[model samples]
Target chain A: MLETLNQTTFLHTVVAIGSFTIFTIGLVGVLSKKNLFKIFLSLSIVESSLFLFFIGSHFEVGKAAPIVADGIKLFDGHMVDPVPQAMILTTIVIGVAVLALSLTFVVNYYRLSGNIDIDKMDELGEVQ
Target chain B: MFNFEITALGNMFFGLTVLVFVSLFFVPNKHRSVTLYSLLFASLACIFYASDLITLFIGWEIMGWSSYFLIAKTADKQTLQKYIVFNIGGAFTLLGAIILIYGACGSFVYSELDFSAVPSGQVTAITILLLLTLFVKSGIMPFHYWVVDSYSQSNDLFSAVLSAIISKTGVFAFILIFFQIITVQYLQTPILEVVAWLGVLTSIIATFKAINEDEAKRLLAYSSIAQVGYIVTILSIMGSLSLEAALYHTVIHTFVKLLLFINVAAIIYVSKQHRFSTLGGLLYKYPLNFILLVVGIISLAGMPPLGGFSSKFLIYTALLEEHKGLLLAAVLFSSASAFLYCYKLVYGIYLGQPTNPKTEAYPRIPLRFYVPQILGAVILITLGTIPGVIVPMFNGILGSVGFEPVLYRGVFVLGSDFASFNGGVVIGAFGLIFVLILLFFVRLKNRSVKPKDRLDISYCGEVPRADVNLHYGYGMGRELSRIGLIKMILSRSSHALWQRVSTLFGDLSGITQKLYTLSAQNMGLVIFAFFTILLYMGVK
Candidate 1:
């Protein structure tokens, strides 16, 4: 029991560290970056961390895939929480949709003003 | 849980299936009736089969795409793309929130999901996600950036749909989630109070922005945000009274925005003029719509004896119940200021003298053009006249959320076992007084007060070109702009925050995008990083 408890804690510690690191990297990129394209890309990274954390927290010991093979079970805690995985799947699809849409925005921005820099947007507040 | 009935499934599939096929039909330019018809069918489907979240999402995404294509007609590709991107971003937030809930409970039906089961942290995350999505589409405060740009760029009638039906979906979604799925008490109130404050702040600032905007469509867009801010404020209260208020405001706002956008669209269509400085004296040109728009503006302004006031009345009561003296005062002040811009939208566009009579305006508006707008406007006025007519409907809508049913006796009355405004009495008294004034005015008038052209006033010592360039939209929202502290730094756009951030992003992406331009390298890195992180976690 103690060993299992220690292992669970260790797994959580890894998850906490990894997702936070990924999040930090994205944050730093978003904060420090000067390119519109890179900012959007960094946002994707941040989104990935959120997905990772969600999926990671739901992970438990001794769980097999929820998908029913001949002897496999469904929705048992022995399996990693399917909920977070399913949510991540949906979020991933949505993230792709938003990314494609935003990238198109970048393309249009480039076409209109021939400038891809955010600092170049002069028509909005205080820019001109 | 509501079972995914074949009928419901079929309705959603119709919109989904037609999206690709209809895209082709809309590809050939000038095929408007077909485009409008397809959208109407899809929108109707969305409205009817609102039980399942996933089914609802399909309708929402397809609606977003359909509207984007329609807006492409009036705007250049870039504006259309921005419009689509911003809307899609909001829609994605919603999808994330929905998926979060479904994941939590293993159900997509709105009816069966229980909030108590949602882990506290997940609930907060889900709420924030839902809030962000709705806030963007609702065009509240910082998210108002896309509102003016996209609405102004869309084809005239399409702008009407953009303002009216689309934004209301945000409110509907809020009602579903916040009022229904998530218990507001379990969530944070200070956050909602802040949202309320933001709503009020946006109203004040955007009202000023609207007044100063020279572009006709942009002015209306800002005005739409300001009105939406009021609706947002009411929604934050999360009570039976507030829910009624929010829904009432949502309905009235839909009609009012459609009224204003349709009139503007008709004006743009007829005269090929968009800016107020370039056009004038339209009260006679589009008489029916001008009156209709006036009714909407008055309703929007929360003036009494109109559909606007009924909803606005509820918002005020909700605020008072909270007993936030300052916030209530602010709400009252912002709405009072709303009247000024309401005046500006009407007088500047319709009542003022035309710069030159010879300047050609668009020919008479088509009847089909007026049909939808008139239908919306008429419902708004008729609702105000008989406030109780829709009280039961609101009761039915709110009933799904398990909120206490607000008292309705042909007029909504709030204040449980305490103070309340009897709307019928107040409205009836006002109506009586109005009739008395009309009779007196009729008795006093006749031969002496012959109504003539809207522009009987002097246009001269005349410089027609100077008149055309005159500023009509300046400094309307100035009073409320003083509260600049409300501007959020984290939003996609606010006070040049996004602009500077995007610029920095642009510079960095310029370097990295090239480095990652090859999919092979980028994919390898992504997969390797993904596996490395997963392995590290799994092994630990």
Candidate 2:
């Protein structure tokens, strides 16, 4: 059963379903949570799901890692494309930085206003 | 990365810019910036000399922003907002048209785009967008919502720039785009007719509104709009003669407005008063300035022995050449009524008895003020005497834009084959009559009895108090409001219409605002919902 599930088409289907499910859970958490920290955390979860989708969809059964050391002489069809993985790696770094910056802003906001609930933060005042 | 060309049209515009800017240098202002003004002048030259849409647009934006900063030095928040919003909206519309042109022709250069290859529908759309931009820039009606506020609220000296130089940019662009770029072969006639009607209608309404204005600058502002309206109307005719007519009017109006606005600025500088009611009895106090203003108004009203009449005559004859009888009638009507506001401008500021007790102590006007006024007066008189002198320049412009030059018979005579006038005869006759009247006035001065007091006038057989309001300026144009036709004109306000439009947009934005809640969860939900919809569409 493990060998059967290791097929390339089957693995792609699994990856799609798994990542989409994770994305939905994050979306639900984001839409249902009132705390700013939880919302941002859910956002990070969504971002991770996107990274997994990109990396996993590009994977194949027999493709080697795109390292050109002992046997691999050039970046050819024998190895999987490294562009999406590289892009995802850069995106992950930026995501972490953004998340940290945003969390810092939230912490400052909470310290100043004594509120983390987005609904209760009425700094913009009444809509008129 | 920008291309530039030097055509006769550009030459004329740059010359006007230099003249107006030099004159404005002598105008005293506390908030004036040489850098900002120099930037504006350079940008204007860039626009006039630009051979491509990109360069034109870049220069246009710089001009708008620099002028905005200049006006912001004195204008209130509301006026500044109006000025920026309308002007930016105009710029964006022009950009849209330019983008459309690029999409069709794959180039920004004027000479590279061929209108024959574009579809008629696309051409019409581009024409309309460009016209809207020009209309807003020129302060033509319906799009002229920002004009009065900006012109009046700007600092005194810059008002002349706003009226004289900046407004002409629109007319210049109209000529550039319609006459040169599009080349009229692909033009739709009905649109031109509508433009002509719009022009005449704007003039008629603005004339009435000018008459109704109480503030001096506001009156001149409305008058400026009306004069530009005539130029637009005449231009819509699209004949060599009409183009010449428009150019003539444009030159005359530049000096006319510069003189009038500067004259009013001098008065305000001295008295700290600009309202018609408080300003009076200045004719004797500042006789030279008063005379200059009279010359300015004479040209403004399109009266004989002035450059204004030569242009107006050309406009009427051009209209007759095309047999646009009804339009000509409306234009004539507007021109005739313009005299009322012109008189009010003069009578309110100078002719009547002094309303303020402090008028006796107002200081002598700075000698610098006379520099521009004398230059303007001399130019106006010279143009009036030799109206055909500017014909060669206009003909060069017409030739450059692919039109036959209108007939010119020496510097004294001005007109086309349809009709012509001897400028020399007109000016000489007026001069002779004027000198005779002056001599008669001097002879009569010996026998004329001096009044004991200003209050010596018999007022319904009763002695009026010193504080009695006797100035005619306050009630000069109030009678026009009672007339049924003019009342109809004055009753309709573009301000109210624009307010309704803004409120409608406000209501629309309010609906959009419902989607934007401050709560983070709701925003997330919106994002999620948007993505889900996109996913569903992609799957489908």
Candidate 3:
């Protein structure tokens, strides 16, 4: 039963469902939260789900990591594709940096105006 | 990256730029910046000499922004806004056309452009876009919303530059891009005819508007628009003679505007007044300025024995050659109406009784101001004396642009096989009559009594009150509004049309603004919804 469940299609299905569930949770948090900080945190959670989905969908059982190490002396088709993983890693780094910067802005904004609720922020003024 | 070449057209424009810029040097203005002016001149030269669309656009943008800064020194916020908006819109259209051409031909260079590969539809689109750009620059009507405000609100000296040099850039580009690069083979005659009508109509309306203007600079601004309109009309004929006619008018107008603007600037400098109501009897105070202004107005009105007439004659002949009888009649109607405003200009400032008490205390105009006026006056007179003198230069330009040179016998005669005139004879006859009149007046005058009090003369056989404003300048063109056709023309304005366009844009942007809420929750919902749609699309 374990051997049968470990099929490529089954793994991809599991990855998709799990990531979709996590993404939905994050989307609910983002939509329900009024606080800017909470919303940003939720956005990060959504980003992580996307990363998991991209990486898991590209992964294959019994495939070597895309690197020339140990038993893998040379690059070959036996290894999983690394481009999507590499792209996700860059995206994660950028996402973290942006999230940190935006949280800092929220902190400073709350200190100045004594509020972090994005709903209450009318600094751009009411649109005519 | 930018390429430039000195064609005969470029050289002619450069020469005109030098003449105008030199005259600008003698103009006294505390706000004047040598750096900005130099930048302007260099950019203008770059535009005139540009061998590619890229270089032309770069120079065009530089010209626009630099002129904005120059005008910003004296213009109000509204005027500056108008100037920037119209000019930038024009520049963007030009950029779009250039991009379209580049996509079609795979090159920005004029010589590399192979329009044969371009679809006729795309060619028309490019032509229209380029024409729109030229129209805005030249302050052609409907696109001329910024012209009056910018010209009048700018410093007196800079106004001359704006009118004389800057406006001509449009004419140059029109000639350069249309005649040389695009070449008239791709152009449709109906489009040319429509342009001709637009030109004549603009002149007619602008002439009436000039008559309505009480301020001197504003009046001259409208006149500048009207004069450029004539050039546009003549140019639309698209023949060797029409091109020559347009070129002649361009040259004459440059000098005419320079002379008139500088003359007005001098008057403003001494009197510290711009309105005609407050300015009168200045002929005796600044006789030289007055005389120079008279010469300018004569040329402006396109009378005989002036450079204006030579160009006007050419324009009429060009129109006749095209068998555009109705258009010629309309142009003549506009030209005839132009005389009313020209007379109003002279009568308001120089011929009437002094309206302001301070006129008696006005000081002598600086000698430097006369330099440009004299230069302009002498050039106009010379051109009037020898109409065909500039023909060789124009012929060179025509030849360079791949057109046959218009026929001309000598420097004294102008025109082709269709019609011709002896400039020398016209000037000589006028000069002789002028001398005889002067001699006759000088010998027979002495019976005229000088009024002790200007209001002492009984008006309608009743003594008018001291406070009564009798300056006819105020009421000069008010009657034109009462006339049926002119009233219809005067009633419509481009301002209302532009205002409606702005409001429409405002409403459109307002719709998009609704989605840009600051609420993080709402923004998150939008993002989530957008992502879901993308995901669904991908999955499908």
Candidate 1 local lDDT, B106-219, one digit each (tens):
888877788787778898888888888788877887666677788898766666667776776677677767776677766877778788899888887786666556677888
For model 3 chain B, the run of ten residues with the poorest summed lDDT: B516-525
Model 1 vs truth, CA RMSD: 17.7
| Tens-place lDDT digits, model 1, residues A1-128 | 66865576677777889999998898667655657788788889989998888777777666676676777655665676677778789999999999999999889989988986655655543211
Q: Write the per-residue lDDT of candidate 2 for residues B198-235, one digit (tens) a residue.
A: 99999999999999998999999999999999999999
Runs in model 1 with CA error above 4 Å?
A1-128, B1-44, B360-362, B411-505, B516-540
Candidate 2 recovers a fraction of native contacts equal to: 0.67
Q: iRMS of candidate 3, one decimal?
A: 2.2
Ranking by TM-score: 3, 2, 1
Better of 1 and 2 by TM-score: 2
Q: Which candidate is the best by DockQ?
A: 3
DockQ scores for all the models shown?
0.02, 0.40, 0.44
lDDT of 3 by residue, A1-128 (tens): 99968888899999999999999899888899888878898889999999999999998888878987876677688989989978998998999899989988999999999998877888874545
Q: Give Cα distance to truth, residue B53, candidate 3, Å.
A: 2.5
Segments in model 2 whose C-alpha atoms lie over 4 Å from true places: A1-128, B447-456, B503-517, B531-540
Candidate 3: misplaced stretches above 4 Å? A1-26, A35-128, B507-517
In candidate 2 the C-alpha lDDT for residue B170 amounts to 97
True contacts kept of 3: 0.67
> Global lDDT for candidate 1?
0.70
